[model samples]
Target: MTAKVAGIPMILCALGVFVGGTIWTIVYSFTNSKLLPKTQWVGFEQYERLWGENRWLTSIENLAIYGACSLILSFVIGFVLAALMDQKIRFENTFRTVMLYPFALSFIVTGLVWQWILNPEFGVQSIVRALGWTGFTFDPLYNADIVIYGILIAGLWQGTGFIMVLMLAGLRGIDQEIWKASRVDGIPMWKTYLFIVIPMMRPVFITTLVIIASGIVRVFDLVVAQTSGGPGIASEVPAKYVYDKMFLSQNLGQGFAASTMMLITVAIVIIPWAYLEFGGKKRG
Candidate 1:
């Protein structure tokens, strides 16, 4: 009873912090607050302004492109890596450690390194040219239509390792009896993994997806460090937009409004998944 009583206050305190921050953001979203908060309420004018702004619209579009590509690429690559690592292959620990090392590195460093490596004049492009491929040109980072994909590649390099770790954990936790049973039944290894293992790992996959989705929604550092919203705002994400408005552009109200929109967008995307995970009818 004492422990429960003591824990209640800490829980309440944490809830208070969360609720308080959310309310503060919501209130700021409704005002014409600049660098500093102002009490003057401007209703939903900030939201209206965002909708009418070209840059913000472009940022939203870019975010969608980056998010979709990152999510798909990360999941696919991570699953493949995890599956490959699960095989009783040589140097399993080395491969696992190599794959997961990227996740340990700071995103800032990842972005910087990738930026250098992808630079048209000095990186892969130059190296290819030096190899007598004079006509080769790898300049996606400079092209508005393709720059977002470049960012996605760098993001995947780091993000996939995270998903790989999660999937590996799920794979390790699977029952060895299932593998033996499949072998006795003459089921192919790939078929067993696809039809049996993958399905059983759904809960872990969903959890990893949610985590990656949150990262996608809140992605900021990679964009800033690598593209800085691009050669023409082609890589701008909602978080970057919010930062620009809050600091560089000095439009706190608009920044908070963008943040609110992001919060709503994330909620919309995640709520269905949450219900499916927690509220759906259970299967035996």
Candidate 2:
């Protein structure tokens, strides 16, 4: 009883902070606030402005493309890497370390490096031109329609490493007897993995998907560092839009409204996913 009483203060303190911050944001979202709070309430005006903004809409579209591509690419690449590593391949430790090392670096640094590499004049395109492929061009980073794919490529480079590690850990926990039995039954290796191992790894995959989705929702640094939503705001995302309005534009009300919209959007998407995942687990 003494220990429980001691813990109560800490729990209460955390709850207080969380509730306070949420209320502050909610209040700000409904006001005509600026750099500093003025407490002038203008309910739904900010939200209406945000909904009517073209840039905000563009940001949402870009985020959809970015999130979908990144998630799919990361999962496919990570699963393949995990499967190959599980085969007792040579220098497995070295391969694993090499695959995961990119995640250790900052997204700012990663984006800068990729920006340099994707530059058409002096990067991969130049190198390819030097190799007698004069007509070759690798300028996806500059193309409005394809710039998001460039960001996705860089993001996947880091994110796939995390998924690889998770999948590898899941693979390692599988019983060796299953593999032996599959071998004894002369089951093709691909069929064994597809029909047997992949199903067993579903929980790990779902968890990884959740983590990736959350990362996508909060993605700002990489977009800012890489493209700065440039090439005509083709790569704008919600987090970047919120930051620009809050800090750069000093439109606090609009910023808060955008943030609130983002929070709602995330909740809408994640609530169903969370229910399906956790609810299924409970039933199981």
Candidate 3:
């Protein structure tokens, strides 16, 4: 009873700050609120305006491209590195530290670093050209069609290390007896990993997916620092759009509506996971 009483403040804060604020944002999204949140309700007008914008649609496409590539490549790269590290090879600690070092830096730093690296005149392209290939062209940041992929490279560099560490921990948790059984049965290493090990790591993968999905949904700082959604708004994302609307354009209603849409996207990802994670167990 005392513990429950002690948690009351936290519960109230969650309700007021999170739940209440979400409700307020959703309600205000329906209003034609400009500099201030006016009481003039405008129904779905803001949403209609939002969906009508080409910039918003482009942002969604960029996000989808980045999200899909990041999700697949990061998981693949991380898991492969973890598998290699699990071999208990020489200087494992040094290799692990080198891989994880980038994750210690903030997204802003990662973006700036990669931005310099991807610069056409002074970066990889220039270096390769200097090395005798006068016709080398490799500038993803400047190209409107491939700018998101450049940012994606930076993101994977920063995030793959963390995912590798998580996967390594999951791999370490598997029983040694399982390995012995596989070995005794003369099962190939690849088959063991693909069939038995991956299935056992379901919870780890789910947690990693949620973390990556949330990051993908709220990606702003990285894009801002990297390209500022540029090469002519080619790499714009939903969060940056909402921020520009609210703070830059001073269009409160539109920002609120965009944010509400973001919330709905998050719910779409989380609700199904939550049901399978908790509800299924309860029913069983």
Clashes within 3 Å, all models in order: 0, 0, 0
Model 2 alpha-carbon drift over 4 Å, by segment: 1-13, 273-278, 281-284
How does candidate 3 fare on TM-score?
0.97
What local distance difference test score does each model get?
0.88, 0.89, 0.95
lDDT digits (tens) for residues 1-284 of candidate 1:
99999899899988889878888999889999997999899898999999999998998888888888888888888988888888768998888888888989888899898899999889999999999999999987888889888888888998788899899899998999999999999999999999999999999988998898888899888888888988878888899999888999898899999999999988987997888887785642
lDDT value, residue 5 of candidate 2: 94
lDDT of 3 by residue, 181-216 (tens): 999999999999999999999989988998899999
Top model number, lDDT: 3
Per-model TM-score, in order, reads 0.92, 0.92, 0.97
Deviation from native of the Cα of residue 141 in model 1, angstroms: 1.7
- Model 2 root mean square deviation, Cα atoms: 2.1
Taking every candidate in turn, the Cα RMSD to the unseen true structure, in Å, is 2.1, 2.1, 1.1
lDDT of 2 by residue, 34-78 (tens): 897779999899999998999999999998998888888888999
Say which prediction, candidate 1 or candidate 3, comes out ahead on lDDT. Answer: 3
Query: Model 2 Cα displacement at 64 (Å)?
Result: 0.3
Evaluated against the true structure, the overall lDDT of model 1 is: 0.88
